[model samples]
Target: MVEIVPFGVEAWLNKREKSAKYDISQSTIASLTMHEVLNLDGNNGQEFYSMLDQQKMNYGWIEGSPEFKQEVAKLYQHVEPENVLQTNGATGANILALYSLIQPGDHVIAEYPSYQQLYDIPKSLGAKVDFWHIHEEANWYPDINELKKLIRPDTKMICLNNANNPTGTILDKQFLEQVVE
Candidate 1:
């Protein structure tokens, strides 16, 4: 028998609810549903009610609709709708990206203390993973020189969380451009 492990932030978050005193987790729809804070106005509520009335609950849309893909693609300046693939959520997206792009023994650099999936999945896939640490003393931002030092000739990927989970630190455009360079 093989042991299966939780693969991403979503799994950890689900487990966290048991031990958590305060519900500070951000990624679940349950939070909104539990709080009864999701406001549906205009056609949104009508469409939802109509779906319920028709008993139309299937798999929803397979691979999302064309308009949905186009909307997601618009977020990236140069990306086309055909290039945008939607998954269950960001965790699924991350897993697919890593599974498709990384091979065993590949070198990967990932930001420290991010969503665990960023690095852990690659490790499970047999990649050599390095953490570019972000210091709390330095307002949780990673130093560019330190990041540069972590990169090696064999590095196949650099994974990051733009707005970090748990810390809520945002990586700005300048820093992202520096990372790209």
Candidate 2:
């Protein structure tokens, strides 16, 4: 039986706030107010409003604006503007990528205690999900030998978080290169 995952951390905090005066469960910093946001980089909201007024804002760019795609492409080596496809956010990108790649009966290895979507969604979609654990004793890094053992010829994808969420354990450059090999 497939177990439904509950609403994520924010939903838990919302319920907690209703019952308790102090909210200590939140992982992220307090959100900034509109007034505080408008003053960013000495911007007085006028520049933002002027830009908004200049656009039709009807669905905007389907494949993201050429300028926006060009700027995002510049962040990667040997990438061009045509290579970048913008989404609403991380969730949209993750869903799109996973749904496109993962099929029923495919085998996927996902890192444990990373983002839930990394594994949970694939499992829910009928793929066999094996967890590649980050050992707490070893400072939250996955054992490379264990990873090597987990791989089979049929393994379709290995999902990882470079820097784990909540735990904030990062896979360093040398370790990442080894994984690539």
Candidate 3:
């Protein structure tokens, strides 16, 4: 029998031990409810209730509504609304991008001590995943030279997280572009 392990976010959430001493891992809805900050009349609550009240959900929009896509497109100056295809969240978007772009046996480089999903999903897809470790001593940013050394002929993808979880380190655009180049 083959042993099946959970992938991506599920694996991270299912961990028996906390990843950090101060990790306050919990449900967002439950936390908001406890704090009394989750008002039903708020933006999401109102939209959610309106949808629920609809006589027919009817899959709503197949690839999400054009208006919704347009709104999302506004976030990027260069990206058009037609390019937007909404998913469950950022995690879903990341998974979709990886699944659509990455192939088996491709080499991928991912930032370390960040979101496990960033690297794990590629690995699960049979990609040879390499880590670019962020040193705590160096304020959690990986050395540029170290990253340059990791890039090779087989490298197909590079994954990173902005405002890295647990550590909360944000990668600036300049550094990100350097990695891209």
Candidate 4:
């Protein structure tokens, strides 16, 4: 039987909590408390809380509200409101994208040292996963020539982390063009 693995950062964070005083492992910035976050609007937080207080205490939308989706769709070109999907978080988005695109026996190449969910989800779905390793000596970027060598006719998807999670390494325009070629 096949089994999925725990998220790398989450697992490491759980273990690190027992001993580490400062966590530098994850990419996310320090979280803001609700009060601190709400106060950022400069209205003493009443307007936002009042809106929430008046909202019905029920599921707002199953596949996101039309208005919410519309607002999201406005940010993109040629995308309709119905095409926008609201997910719980990054993990949810990753899972949804992977599940929708991958099938058993499909091939996937995921850039290494990213948030593991990129590759792990596809692996859990039974896709053959190959790592496009980033070279530390070359500043944590994947070599385009190496990527060309790894591609197979069965390759269904290629995953990349824009500004990679922990190291913040970005794939530049020239490198991206080379990959496209």
Candidate 5:
């Protein structure tokens, strides 16, 4: 029985997302109407609407279409299309990855002021979660020395938003390479 704490940001948004006016707190793009979406879609972007070519859309491939996987693989340098997994979305992908890799009593370190789901999910799964706090004085970067201190022989995982979500500050390639080593 997982005793998950109520997600604060989600709860706050659910209570006011529809009713609030001048809601500037939103980090993601505001919802757009179908009409606006249609206008936004370009000449070849009828694909966005899945302009049906009378193709029977069954469950399709278990790992998504080969073409789709290939296209996704193109975005990465060394990744193969076969290695590219097509999940429902970011949250679903996160859920799958965390559930697959995390276990009860495992030690996990996640960035502070990140999407709560990253840390909260691990906690709910019985992981000992630690906050790797980011500082505004350092442009929201977490010191590598601090991270080294957090690491232990028993540490199971270190979760990061990659491109610090909510704040939108990116962890450059060099910084990530240093973390890897």
Candidate 6:
């Protein structure tokens, strides 16, 4: 069994969220009701009842519904509807991806101070994980030169967060192009 460290942000939220008047620590937007979600999906609020009556709501689709997958594919350059996947959430997606890719003795470079899962899962998988520091001094972006230095011949994977999570520092396309080059 893998031993993962406790997630502090969740703990803090669980402990402090109820009492806190203005919660800046809330990572996502306020929770929405099923009706609000259906409305946002461009359906009438009553669609939830229609869905429950017409479709099986007991379980999720294996690869997501064709309609949902097609919508997801539209967001990417060349992704196909058949190739698009749906996970439970971001953390589950990260776990699935990291576990699938990283093997023992592999070299992985993950952005420092990003989501803990990005670095932690790879390290636990027996990969030699390197941190690509993103500091405020050079702005939030990791130094491309530093990245170049970190890449070894044995490097199996490079983990980059387009937007560093806690800081919400985004790496734009031109900077990404430089990294790819």
Best-fitting candidate, scored by lDDT? 4
Candidate 6 stretches with Cα past 4 Å from truth are 34-44
Colliding pairs, model 3: none
Clashes of each: 0, 0, 0, 0, 0, 0
Flag the better candidate by lDDT, 2 or 4.
4
Q: How do the predictions measure up, each by TM-score?
A: 0.79, 0.87, 0.77, 0.89, 0.87, 0.86
TM-score: which candidate is best?
4
Regions of candidate 3 where Cα sits further than 4 Å from its true position? 1-23, 26-55
- What C-alpha root-mean-square deviation, in Å, does candidate 5 show against the real structure? 2.4
Q: Rank the candidates by TM-score, best first.
A: 4, 5, 2, 6, 1, 3
Tell me the deviation in Å of residue 96 in model 6.
1.3
Tens digits of per-residue lDDT for model 4 on 1-181?
5679987678777878659987777666788999898998799788899888989989679999899999999999999999999998777898888989999999999999787889888898899999999999999998888899899999999999888876799999888778777
* Cα lDDT tens digits for candidate 3, 58-166: 7688899899999989998899988999899887899898989887899999999767777877887888889999999988898889999999999999888877765
Least well predicted 10-residue stretch by lDDT in candidate 3: 26-35
Spell out the clash pairs found in candidate 6: none
**What RMSD does each model have against the real structure?**
3.5, 2.6, 4.4, 1.9, 2.4, 2.4
Model 2, 82-150: lDDT tens digits are 999999887789889998998889999998877888898888778998989899999999998988998
Question: Which digits, one per residue and each the tens of the lDDT, describe model 6 over residues 1-181?
Answer: 5666667777888999899988987557799886777787476756666767887657667878889999999999999999988888878888899999888899999998888788878888888989999979877888999999999999988888666778878899998998888
lDDT per residue for candidate 1 within 86-146, as digits (tens), equals 7988878888899899888899999998888888888888889999988898888889999
* lDDT agreement of model 5 with the native: 0.86
lDDT of 5 at 168: 79
Higher-TM-score candidate of 1 and 6:
6
Task: Give the TM-score (vs. native) of candidate 4.
Answer: 0.89
lDDT pick, better of 4 and 5: 4
Q: What overall lDDT, based on C-alpha atoms, would model 4 receive against the true structure?
A: 0.88
Ten-residue segment with the worst summed lDDT in candidate 1? 34-43
